[model samples]
Target: MAKGLKKTVVLVGMMGAGKTAVGKAIAQILNVPFLDSDAEIELAADRTIAEIFERDGEPFFRTKESQVIERLLNDERCILSTGGGAYMRADNREMILEKGVAVWLKVDLNILWQRVRHRNTRPLLQTANPYETLRDLAQTREPMYAKAEIVVEAEPGLSVEQMAQKVVDALVAHGGIVKDT
Candidate 1:
């Protein structure tokens, strides 16, 4: 239940890690709202993330991202899904850790590639040889992601609902963040 958590469950991970989907499932199971920072940004800007990246650049998007993340984390406790790059910033990471329990949804590189390769919506993967780009991004960002208070490993065949349950189970197991009662 939502009452089990003292703070929001901030889901952080790579693009294909199913943060949004799993966050939705978690929120449903917990009886709380699911807030997505990227979606909030899109709603505020009246444009898609790819469009924002194309027009204003990533630095600008990231500035808005930090703003949205802070706002979302500041709101009522919920399952908050953040963009893949949100945890890459120290300030955002600090804010997340301060306001919510950060859960890193760690997925395998091959599984990540499989999940994201066909999606044109991801701006970061729009480079030449996206597989290599995703690998590079993962290698660059994983150490920071590893700093999350909770790390939930993702399996290749698990459904979104199952992953959400795994995340909630991990939270309960973590003790201080989520109470079993």
Candidate 2:
């Protein structure tokens, strides 16, 4: 495991960008805690994200997501994986920027589509034409994602561990965020 992380690493991107999986691997390698804002929300609400969306609404879900993200950012230095839409809100983005290192995982639409197509868990993609919805969401969000301090491309066919290592390498090479204890 690696050590001596100066700040929390917040993983942000689309739903299928592997934020949770890669964040878990990165946290394990860094010997830091892994926090998923979605999981936290689910635990707190006693319901799945989809259920929450169905019950209250997207506005309610976004509010809860922001709250959970703020709470998580205030916690110990760790790897935090946020819901795909978390960073879209300015308040949430500000909180993440203030409290953690935001790394946007950039993946192509086809790759993202492939990863998310089979899964019916995405609230936003629960549309009549999910593929087009995803594409449109990606287009709208790419500019905001580009505002992140670091950008790590998601290569097709890479294992989760490799993707995590790639993020580590990006941190070391670009910002020196992680170092030997």
Candidate 3:
């Protein structure tokens, strides 16, 4: 339907939680821009996130991440997909709350594992015991993720379009968007 957004939708969650995928679909539905904080950071750093972590480390990458998030939040309202760890910081969470409505895509551990297990792109999951690592991350981050303004539970077997529509419906219900979902 291409309904426009009244507020920026900041997609936040774990690495395999479908933030980027659902965000792209949401932007298309809303006729708005889809901005990924991680992608922006990569463009600014001229390197991959993995490379950034390898060379400069997580703290440095997080600093650049905060800067990029601030810049994007100040731009036109868009569907902003953030890195998995972005919402873990208090400053980042505060800024997101002020400028946009945060949507946490809550997915089950098994589903998240299935989605990300084969992918080497996630720097954090590159561990000796990747499955255990993913489980631990989900456990640790769930509390922070629960602080998001809107929580959209991602059910298994739903297509990206379906998941996006669910988010849109949630936004309308929460008054985050003035649109027909």
> Model 3, 63-170: lDDT tens per residue?
999999999999998999999999999999999999898999999999999999999988998999999999998899999999998999999899999999999889
* Model 3 lDDT on a 0 to 1 scale: 0.92
> Roughly what TM-score does model 1 have, to 2 decimal places?
0.96
**Runs of candidate 2 exceeding 4 Å displacement:** none
Each candidate's lDDT (Cα)? 0.92, 0.91, 0.92
Error of 1 at 17 (Å): 0.3
Clashes within 3 Å, all models in order: 0, 0, 0
Q: What is the lDDT of residue 17 in candidate 3?
A: 90
lDDT at residue 152 of model 2 (Cα atoms): 98
C-alpha positional error of residue 167 in candidate 1 after TM-score superposition, expressed in Å = 0.5
- Can you write out model 2's per-residue Cα lDDT over 35-86, one digit (the tens) per residue? 9999999999999999999999999999999999998888888899999898
TM-score for every candidate vs. truth? 0.96, 0.96, 0.96
Worst 10 residues of 1 by lDDT: 172-181
